[model samples]
Target: MITLVRTNDIVLISLIEALLREARVPLFVADAHVSAVEGSIGAFPRRVMVPEDHAAQARRLLRDAGLGAELAPSPGGS
Candidate 1:
């Protein structure tokens, strides 16, 4: 899997999750539970990830949803 977005904004995370789920893209939100260890002070951001096979489609889907700016930088040098 590859990360597509990472942030402390739960709203944004939820939006991405819903979008991906609706599109049937494989999804995983890593570090989602780390807030418990960090006292939910926004110390650790959650990550939105998709299977490598879905990466391109997921990125396009998110961009179409106006979340292009929120995407993690493409893996350096491809």
Candidate 2:
């Protein structure tokens, strides 16, 4: 799991998720409960995870959407 992006902005999360999904990149939602708890308090941090193999693809897909840069190297990759 990695924190690809963080923001107290609720709309951004949904937008990013939808964009990623539309691009055929599956992402795991993390700290979702926290987001609800904080109610976007000063920007709640959310975690998004993908398999090691899909990590790079995920990053690229997100970047292409103008989300943010890749956070880390995938420990598992081709």
Candidate 3:
């Protein structure tokens, strides 16, 4: 999996999740339960991830939706 976005903003994560779902892109949210363990202090940022094969398309989708600034750098540095 590749990290597409990582942040403490739950709203942004939800919005991105919806966008990805609407576009039919598979995704997984990492560290989502950390908040429960950490009392919602927001220290651990949740991560949005997609399969390696779908990273580029997912990044493009988020970028087009005015979320380019939230995108994580690709593993290959592209």
Candidate 4:
């Protein structure tokens, strides 16, 4: 099964998705809800999923894009 990860914002989400695509990471849409933070109704809050194997690499890619911090995963999950 695929795993879903949240992007901080719609623009960041799109950027990360595009970058992931360019990197050849397989993607799937899990959810794409609107975020109230953007306050435009359809402003943001989209989420996406990739194959489980690619999750780490996806987070690393986002970290590389300056979206979030990357560290070794904790004992339980990937």
C-alpha local distance difference test of each model: 0.89, 0.65, 0.91, 0.62
- Give the per-residue lDDT digits (tens) of candidate 2, residues 1-78: 555555555677777778768877667777778778877465567666665566667777777777654344445432
The better-scoring model by lDDT among 1 and 4 is 1
Off by over 4 Å in 4: 1-4, 33-44, 69-78
Q: For candidate 3, lDDT tens digit of each residue in 1-78?
A: 999999889899999999999989999999989855886678889999999998988999988999999999999887
Least accurate 10 contiguous residues by lDDT in model 4: 69-78
Better of 2 and 4 by lDDT: 2
How far out, in Å, is residue 65 in model 2?
A: 1.8
- Among all windows of 10 consecutive residues in model 2, the one with the lowest summed lDDT is 69-78
- For model 2, state the Cα shift of residue 74 in Å: 6.0
Comparing 1 with 3 on lDDT, the higher-scoring candidate is 3
* Shift in Å, residue 49, candidate 4: 1.0
Clashing pairs in 1: none
Clashing residue pairs in candidate 4 are: none
lDDT of 1 by residue, 1-78 (tens): 999998989899999999999999989999978855787688888899998889999999999999999999877533
> 73 in model 4: Cα distance from truth in Å?
8.7
Q: Backbone clashes per model, in order?
A: 0, 1, 0, 0
Q: Candidate 1: global Cα-lDDT?
A: 0.89
How do all the candidates rank in terms of lDDT, highest first? 3, 1, 2, 4
How large is the C-alpha RMSD of every model relative to the true structure? 1.4, 3.6, 1.0, 4.7
